[model samples]
Target: MKPRLGVPSDLEAVTSAVIRTMPLDPQWDYRFPYRHQYPADHYKFTRMLFEYFLDPSFDDWLVMVAEDSLAPGDSISVVSFGVFDISYVNKRRHGPGYKPQDPVTEVENRGGKTRRDANHKHFNEFWKGQIRAYKKYFAPLGPEQMHLQILGTLPEFQRRGHASSICRWAMDHVLRKSLKDMSVMASPMGYNLYTVLGFERVGTFYIQVPGEDERLVLQAMMYKPKIWETKTTEDGDGACVML
Candidate 1:
């Protein structure tokens, strides 16, 4: 499968796939319990988040989707996707350019707070806390590093190298642009894959759910470009070694 840049038109399908694949992650499931209980509400919220990602003004981010077809067609199935940013510092500085309007005020102006509204507020706060914690500890390797915000493959399409392919594409782009490093907060399910791709574990942290007993463990991993050289020993043996 080849990896292609994702467009705004692919947002809905990609978001749906994300909703399906993300809960396969223990942390996502724990954070968004509504995904299993109230799928409709979950889908609505997920779509909103993806919409923000796909906004035209948010050009600092790159969304890559892996497609099965060799040629262009009317419709393409996105088996996997990776969201990358050239630099997190730039993203933070420019921002998404759109802030969500007050939903509670709108609802209350029309009527009283509904249970669904309350739930949405609670979940939003929960996620905001997560973001705050992430920002608190997320110190980039340098201004030259690229950040992998998220990466996932559909369950049926996983283990077929789709995720690896997308990762390789992004890493190549970073290297070509002379970026010094790449980084990601890897889930347990993806930790091994990232390691095999040469991302070294720098540290680990846990996300504390508001009222839940379980905390989500995330591995902080980083990759720096390495130079390898071929050398011949005095015995006439040749080997590849890091320079």
Candidate 2:
């Protein structure tokens, strides 16, 4: 199946698939560990987060999904989805754009049932680590790169290559749009796939609150687009150096 830009109608399935798959990610579990115990509030805030992303007016990201078309112009089963951040690629810088009391952010800040179930005590410090990793490590890569903010495939849909399909879409988009590079915060589950896709691990970073023993680490991977190489020929003309 081909990947397409997601719409508001796709929000539920996209959020569903994400909630199903993200638990395998240690960081996701660390932050939202009560998802299973508090499914209602879990879905409530999770949907809010995804809805914020899929808002038709938000152009900073392109939420791409792979679906199973059940019939001709009928129904679809969204098997997997990805949130690809184009903020840098699109020339719009997001300096922690979320304002105070954003419903989603408030959930992380201990404002409601969602926040009560979340990692209220540690998420703030953990989030600070993420920001430090971004500014100190990722920022130097510049603003012409694309980032895979998050990727999720339903647990039942694993091994179907849906994740790779979305990743390839990002790679194609990078070259297609003349972007310099593509980036991803690779989880342990996706590290090998991104590596096989030609994304090199730039480094690794950790998220931990001081005095806490638990640590969550993730790899920062970057993909350099492949393009035709040109060299000067004997006749002083440029020639393609085929790989």
lDDT over C-alpha atoms for residue 182 of model 1: 80
lDDT of 1 by residue, 1-243 (tens): 678888889898889889878878776755566555667766665666566566556655678888653356745588798877654446446565534233323334443232232244444444454455445545434456677877998887778899999999977876667677788878899999999999888777766646866566788778777765779999989987866
lDDT of 2 by residue, 50-168 (tens): 88678766666679998875357967699889887777633544444532223346444454433544775556665677667767757786677777878888887777888899999
Q: TM-scores of all models?
A: 0.73, 0.83
Winning candidate number (lDDT): 2
Candidate 2 stretches with Cα past 4 Å from truth are 69-75, 89-114, 229-243
Q: Per-residue error at 228 for model 1, in Å?
A: 8.8
| C-alpha lDDT of candidate 1 relative to the true structure | 0.69
TM-score of 1: 0.73
User: Per-residue error at 178 for model 2, in Å?
Assistant: 1.4
